[model samples]
Target: MGELDSTLGAVLIAGLLAAVLHGLTILQTFLYTQTSGSDGPLMRCLVLFLWSVDTLHTALISHTLYFYLVTNFGHIGVLAAPTWSIIVAIYLTSLTGIIVRIFLAYRLFLLCGRYRPRLRVALPAIVMIPTMITFLTGLIFASKAFIVRLFARLDTFSVYLYITFSAAALADTLIAVSLCVLLYRSRTGIEQTDSLLTTLIVMTINTGLLTSIFALLCLITYSIWPLKFIYVGMYFSLNKLYVNSLLGSLNARKILQAKQERSTHDHRRSVRSTRFEVVSEPASYLSPAESITMSGVAQKESFASTSNTLHQNHVPDQT
Candidate 1:
């Protein structure tokens, strides 16, 4: 009973949580397609591809859960045998993570200013090494899981699991750090731009930390309890996090851009308002007749200044 609770029950809970995240994923994907009209076709296709993959991943998990708890209900021996859907789901998880990593890495590349040294340009490309390792190892793990197809012998493949997760963690950490460094360097010394960059840096840290922590947790739980399904549960949720993080970053761009535009507009409006106040301040102390005469004089001065500027601009320069 306790084993069932730890293995099957843990998976059940994880699946439910994953389902919730999947719901959020669907909402985000819909929102992105609708709101991100300015995004290029390639980006649109990428989002669509990820959403399709995630939906398929969810279906696979659902099948696995049904097989274990529904079709094979009360069958303890069935727990020892792994379902094909479960094995394949891990591969899909790895695929999602790698795709997102690649996307973020490219963003980092562009973030590095064109005039910067080659080392900065190459840093994000270098991070792909660990990203590739993570994908390859995950592929190997899934292949081995297919061959073994038994929970009891899963521990034999612990080395591959460790390598896969470690590489993922390392890759995520590198991408986050690289982005932060580049964004920090790209700061324009303007308050608004610098503030926007700081927000991006904080976002990078948070998203990177989230995925890396999940990978580490997956590694740790498996190391301690190889035969249990707790790690598998964590793995299920981890992939969803990757997809959500990518979507969140993409969606945030529109918001940040809007904020910048709004701030600039507000600043200009404030400046105009201040100029008006300055022109009217002296008039506040004048009697009504005096104020009327001052206003007329001010209008004449403004018209004279505008006429002079236009005449100067249109007149030919005498050499």
Candidate 2:
């Protein structure tokens, strides 16, 4: 217990640091909304959950290491006893992280997977089985005595740690590979909403690859100091995912705006191209009823001319 006192300090410091970074990231998100008038409650919620879990994870791992390595490290006078409260914290953090992580993976699958009613569902189900198995393996790996009992070749706790890392790596690899297939196939059908879809795809791939590499590194101690500085880096996704969902929401808005503008332009062009006109009535010809009303006009004009000619001939006869 006394030998690893400084290691406990190191763990606590790292946890505190992670917690502080998470706080700052969330604060930044709030500031961005205040300044831009573009708020995202869902994204904020996801990030908040992620960061909180990571912090809780740090606490649980820290407590567990202290109990196992310090309190029960073959101490002479003091003995380790089961504390109900501590056990609850352990279950809450470890289980919660696994559950949330799986939830995020499922969300990603829905976002990127091909669209066929049957295949749409079956793909996620296939990915889930492997993911759950890997997560269960992680829990088993955490219990040093239990796992050692099952596998004799792995004598030390360190070997089981490697197994845990391997399981995580395997799960991450599955997610990465599956998503890559989704991304490749997306080019065939509907036009993707650019920024949002790209972000979703890229992050899915990045997180998958990065997490896998981290797990792989856990196996190789020759690596740089086991990344113990981050205090359960698994939940760090919360901070990074903060802006991702917001960007997706904004992307949707832009796409809709573009569609509306295009529709308006097309409507105006159609109207301009149309040719509508009023019919003109004929004025040169009269109808049968109008011709009857006009019959007296020609007769009156002929009588005036004949009367003038007769007056001139009568004057000649009188002379």
Candidate 3:
């Protein structure tokens, strides 16, 4: 096989790897549903929807690779040829990205709270608009690929692709930053609560960084090495990362919940032990002054009760 063929094969290999990850995420989602059993209908539907989109994305990309490698068989020219499957794959990728972004944006909105000013709500939404626009523009330009057989004629297409990736990266960065900030601010002085929040912050950053870096890499590789299919592999894996990130975030809640519960249980136990110690302490262990003070208080209480009883008897005799 030629160098170009080998490069294309690498793209396929990347797609396969992405598919494997996607399968694992599917299992994770399934296990999450079975184990958690508390996710509402909306959450369940969202998981199913994201999984379906991911499945479609994998199928489309696999078809595109299969068509190029198996059917065309060494026809390097087919790489430049825009097939229907390739167009659909591009569309699906964009769709998957937008859906995930929307989900994240909603999360940010909820985290910020409804009482937050309108500007805060609008900020993330505004940033995401460009991302959606660029993705749509990229999809539109991809359709133009069919007519513009000359790869050189598709120079403008690269601009749309780059913008799309940049916008996506920017949005991801905003999401991560916002989530981290909100989570940090929400931290109570309590150790257990803060620790849980810290875990969430770390996960948010890691997941956001993973997708943003992939998007940036795709943008860089596509712009610099337009002739090669190296960037295509990253592009194929991009949606998988997004899906996995979302599912992983969702599944992580169970773990966080368990930890939080354990922390609470330990805290309660400590409190109970403290109270028991305070209650069970013997008076003999008190200081001499404290014991004298206790005896005087008890004597006063007894005298007051006897006086009250005598006053009641005298009142009946006078009546």
Candidate 4:
């Protein structure tokens, strides 16, 4: 009943996206308990928040997209009870997700010396304060204009939608810029240990960039093609990437630690062997005394030094 067609293929795709988001939500929720540490709590909370909201947002967007364009269900129309409310929820959720994402971006940005100042200024407001303000503001207005109360007054609420959505888009753009700077700075010196961190940082930046673009597109039109339905699905995959990359990094670090421990033990053994001395005294205590020197150990040590060149190249490069 909306100004859109009902194609079954679109509905099917929407369903698939919804399913993906839901699954990601469940996985993240289950893994959250295993995550622990000082910053881990915060990151896990952010992830959980994003995934949970994404599940709802994606489901709503998919259904909205389906009803309007994908499926000619008997109950399809603007007059559908949840239409405008779902739009408000999606708009709010998208913005919240962006805030959480920017928090992640800044967390990485702090590791890049150049962007720490920018993060210190921007991240706190975006993640902690402004999100609550924006969500509360939208809820206040949207509650007053619930679909049932204003199904006939839909046109009037369009202005509010534009206002809230534009605010969210602007916030996201600011975040994208901060992350772009961070990623640009991180490219050269990122160590293998930090590879996962680098990936999340890049993914956060790219996701923010794409989300901002999509939000802008939504502002420019009300068409089905530019619908905000796919944001949740995108969030799901990116979070999975973030979690997996970090998890692998942690595993690799543990393995490396174990290898270092074994190498240390062997090095100590070799050092002891290289300096080893076997002391001996001939038969009677007072009659005759003889000392057997560790020339064998000394000779072996000299041979090792000449053959290996380990000591010669052990010093670090100052530059």
lDDT by residue (164-263, candidate 4, tens digit) is 4465466556655655554455443313323433554555565555555655555554333333333223322332333332333223333344544564
Q: Compose the digit string of candidate 1's lDDT tens values, residues 62-130.
A: 998999999999998898888999888988998999899988877766655466658646887799999
Where model 4 places Cα greater than 4 Å from the true spot, the runs are 1-15, 28-95, 98-102, 105-119, 122-137, 147-152, 186-201, 223-319
User: Could you estimate the TM-score for every candidate?
Assistant: 0.85, 0.48, 0.82, 0.51
Winning candidate number (TM-score): 1
- Return the TM-score for candidate 4, rounded to 2 decimals: 0.51
Clashing pairs in 4: none
Going through the candidates in order, what is the number of backbone clashes in each?
A: 0, 0, 0, 0
**Model 2 ranges with Cα > 4 A deviation:** 1-13, 24-52, 58-93, 112-118, 144-160, 188-196, 222-319
Error of 2 at 71 (Å): 12
**Cα distance off (Å), candidate 1, residue 96:** 1.1
What lDDT does each candidate get?
0.81, 0.45, 0.72, 0.46
Error of 1 at 71 (Å): 0.7
2 against 4, candidate with superior TM-score: 4
Candidate 2 pairs with clashing backbones: none
Summarize candidate 2's per-residue lDDT along 22-119 as a digit string, tens digits.
45545654554444334356544654565455456445555645664576666522222322323344344345435545654565456443546676
* True-structure lDDT of candidate 2: 0.45
Q: Whose lDDT is greatest here?
A: 1
Better of 1 and 4 by TM-score: 1
